[model samples]
Target: MSTIERKTVVLTGASGGIGMATAKALTERGFEVIAVVRDPSRVRDVGAVFQADLANLADVVRVGRELAEKVPRIDVLINNAGLHAFSQRTTVDGLPVMVAVNHVAPFLLTHALLPKLRASRGRIVHVASDAHRRVTTLSLPDDLVRTAQFSARESSFLYAQSKLLGVLFTKALARRLNGTGVVANSCCPGLNVTGLGRESRTFAALAKVLAAVGAFSPASGARIVVRLAADPESGSTSGTHFSRDGSVKVDTTLVANVALQEQLWAETARLPAVSSLGDFR
Candidate 1:
């Protein structure tokens, strides 16, 4: 009898609603779940949980190196951690918090663990959003790192722009990993009563109302992520955005621009958080 080998998935934000749901579903399916959480004390019943603040690049680099050193092999990486805000704020690293967590941190971590992913012929699933379509214009690489004064409404647009970057990053990463058997894709899990908007009381109240009135459950919202991460058919579905119906579509016109994607990749490589690590590009 041939023994079956359990597949391992590294998931960020595994302590939250959608993430906790993904962890449960994967474990039940016999996948070893390695959770990258903001607080280990809040995480339970995963294979292993490593705590790190995604808003901080130094911590991201530290944890990425640790995973690369210790995890041996990774069959999938789910960049599910994210944040939304009604106000603009910068991190200690001098980058916008939304941009740092939603895009750059995942980019750095994925690159740092590229070797393990390649060894396993793994998949990369970014938890992006359809919100990207809401963005009207972006200044490219410049808008990625710089944040200026903006109203609450403008902040929402800024958040949308950050998610747009995630979509673009997925496409760019897929291009970079071509012929390497390490595929990358992204999905927009429909809004659920998650902690993504805890920064604002109004949004939190609105989310509760939406959840009560038939918003998708965290488990249901997690379906797209689970599919993109573990579905055999999804292994080859790179450089696309998946909706709730499993339909493939471009997240936005900006994400579809190859030139913009390449520019984003090059500029992302130049980010202080990534470039300071030396030659990961």
Candidate 2:
């Protein structure tokens, strides 16, 4: 008897939340799971772990390049790490913390490892959210660089806007990757039982109560992500929004607006943080 080789999956935020559960599921499915985490000590039972604090753009870039260099055959790249701050916070780069971690870091990492992904024809899955609808309007170019202090109550709308940007990025990236054999898609993992500690103590306690009632378990939340990332049936799928269900794509003006998506892509590429990385596909 011989041990079978597993596909490579580079997952961010694997130390906790849906990412941790997704890491477990992907491992069980016979994929070699490589975790890109902020704290390496916190990660366990994965094939390997790479450290990168997504809130810091420089660290993300460095780690992204490292992963691209080290992980020779990446079959799936899941930009699954994200954060929700009730009170406004900014990264060292002066960008909003949520925007920096959720959107910008993933964008940079994807670009950094794109060559490997293209070579392997891998799948890219982003954990997005339905809260995008909470934001009725999106100000492009400006939103990409917008920085402001937001209250806890107002953070939801800002968080919604950030996920909306992910949807837009998926649309644009799928277009760029049309002939490259790399597929890109985003999904809302639903409200989950894990990752509550990062938000606040109140939410953490709420999560415990929710879990006691058997609601939003991590495995169930990670199912669609696992399917989108490794399922052969999903290989050709791109630019689709997997909302509560992948069979029914989520409909959002932001997701469908190609012109807006294109604009967002261009502006993101031109951002000082991203542009400093040089021209990226």
Q: Which candidate is the best by lDDT?
A: 1
Worst 10-residue lDDT window for candidate 1 reads: 1-10
**Which portions of model 2 miss their true places by more than 4 Å?**
1-5
Regions of candidate 1 where Cα sits further than 4 Å from its true position:
1-4, 211-214
Candidate 2 lDDT by residue in tens digits, 67-111: 988877888899998888898776788788888888989999998
- Give the clash count for each candidate: 0, 0
What local distance difference test score does each model get?
A: 0.87, 0.84
Q: Tell me how candidate 1 scores on lDDT.
A: 0.87
